[model samples]
Target: MKKSFNGNNVEICAPAGSWESLSAAIRASADSVYFGVEKLNMRARASENFTAGDMAKISRICRKSGVKPYLALNTIIYDSDIPEMKRICDSAKSAGISAIIASDIAAIEYASSINMPVHLSVQANVSNIEAVRFFAKFADVIILARELSLGQISGIVRAIEKEKIIGPSGKPVRIELFAHGALCVSISGKCYMSLAAYDTSANRGDCYQPCRRRYIVKDEETGFEMAIDNQYVMSPKDLCTIRILDKILDAGVSVLKIEGRGRAPDYVSSVTGAYKKAAGLWNKGRFSISAAKKLEVGLESVFNRGFWHGGYYLGDKAGEWSGISGSAATLKKIHIGEILNYFHKAGIAEINLSAGGLETGDEILITGHTTGARKMKIGSLRIEGKSAVRALKGQVATFPTDFKTRKNDKVYLLVPSS
Candidate 1:
């Protein structure tokens, strides 16, 4: 049955939080990236958003690395925020942003006025053909709501094909889908809990993540309230679509978006690289259960908030909406070395290599009480002030560090989850 499927022209889109994550995405072979400029994007509150002056640099870097950069302006806009929004839109146009992911009608109109391409954000709640037809007038692409099933997505694709909505390039409009990442407890990420809790609207990019907090369930009529104990009733499991890549592609989605702008570089590289390989396998008509499991292990190793599920892709099953009873962290790291000495002035830390060897481009995770868990790659490795590619098992290796480390901070080599 898989032999009948085709995966040609499918694009893998990743998230970029900073230059480190951006470079990691490119190295992992992501075809494109979606990022925020400042506080205008939904993930801006949790991410280190770029400044306006960094727009041109972002465009140049992505283009040079053979990747496309899409500016995300998906937050709601108020009347008082019009001028600044217009300025950002104008800067996006000048920076050659591939497309603007927007939810506001004003943003759509601004993109149209500036002759910039637009993509309808999922925040638009586009579930039916009517909504698609309406947004088709302003957007070249419409990201479907996350609540749709595979059959429903196929139906929407068929319906749009009949509408004859041409894209900005005069071709048929494209459909993009969220293939992986965190799932929202609310209906398509339109939640009011944050506003109710702290008067900060999530749609306005000031969310406080009230959903991840502990809560007590209560019955008003009986006046009874009790704690669930170790369970987050409102937290949904992260989404993983590796097992259903063929089905999604068969539904006519040309772009697959991986959601994570607030994650570490290792997370970006691991997830994006796994999907890139998975999509390639599907295109070759060789996708199998073992291949999917391998990809799943890689995903679990980097991060798994509550675990993974098919999410809405599995449809309205009885337990599809239930939350998890605690998060699970997998993927044990291999002990490599321990901190020996530090040259704080030079931003370098010396490690007494013991177990595993160190090589350039190898990712290392440093952990301590004060240092926490910081992940970085070996951009430069030295042995006694001389450049070295691979530090042997007993050699003292020196690598650059960004944060202050304690005397006994441990270093571990990160690998795919076993």
Candidate 2:
């Protein structure tokens, strides 16, 4: 972990939408993880949310791994939804969750009444010092608005220290920033395009993502139609700050949050590992341009809408839009098979190949609720107790592995994207 200019250890906060993503984040060295449950979070419709019964298990796993767990209850609340919202907050507190990330005043006040810590969500659009001072009454940490410049963030940080503003924790309020992942074109993600187009409210966590599609302009009188060539005009490029991480830390930001609760396990692993490694290098004074560039390439192997430094962070007034429709990842995974059994003592795994064949030296990935995301190269292969160079479909192959894998874990082969 790197230390910020204010002498606080910079934290890497990762997103987890499922057990697989949570496990991957822990293994990849994330200091804290945030997740959604029971359709009360901003990513509710985009992710496979956990149930109330899974709270204890999630807390236990995070505690055993020395990672803090945060439950997100940031969605807009209706009068009818208050009962369920309170139930979730009470459950999180009883289960030993570190904090609740919230936006609505109702959720914030409810959590505070139960003595549970709170971190203000980005949906609050806290941009200036006065907003920080106001929200400091309820939240110990406030994720600043994504559209602020570095100078604005630094000013707010300085104000917190000078005014001696403290939260319910009796400590000065800390500032968190979004260091990577999807960039919403709307102001602090308060968008109505999804609701207006698909009748799904983004504030209620059910956005249809209509902004990522292509569009054209039509003239009413002339009957002319012109397509926006080769660009998704409403979609902004994903934020990537590995190269400028030191600058962000120098700005006195405490937490670097990655925004991807809807992503896959491999995406969670790759992004978390990349940021962790870059932070370590920055702490050691080894985060050179070449090293940062290499890390960015590793990030490109996973899900992304292309990379760009956030416009406002760099003092730019215009947005950098994505040229393509979907992810621009350099590599994609193909389903190969599933695990049949694991020989723990022999350090071997027996796999039932249902699709693509596996060859020696081939790169493979295994993902499951327990196994997480494990990537390794095949050293040798054996089919039906006979030595072989390759294993084809419908055959059971045994391969040596240093890590434990569970039965029914999905296996995949890595291939270059077209």
Supply the global lDDT for candidate 1: 0.80
Per-model C-alpha lDDT, please? 0.80, 0.90
Residue 186 CA displacement from its true place in model 1, Å: 0.5
Per-model TM-score versus the true fold: 0.80, 0.97
Model 1: per-residue lDDT, tens digit, 110-207?
98889999999999988888888788888888899988888888888877676666666566677889988877788875888899999988887778
Model 2 Cα lDDT, one tens digit per residue, 1-418: 4577456677899999999999989999899999999888999899889998899999999999999999999988999999999999999999999999999999999999999999999999998998998899899999998888889988888888888888999988989999999988799858999999999989989999888988788899998998766558889899888888877777889899998999999999999999988888887777777898888887999999898865578778646889888789998899999999999999999999998799999998999988888899999999888888999988889999989999999999988898
Best by TM-score: 2
Could you say which candidate leads in lDDT? 2
Residue 144 lDDT, candidate 1, scale 0-100: 92
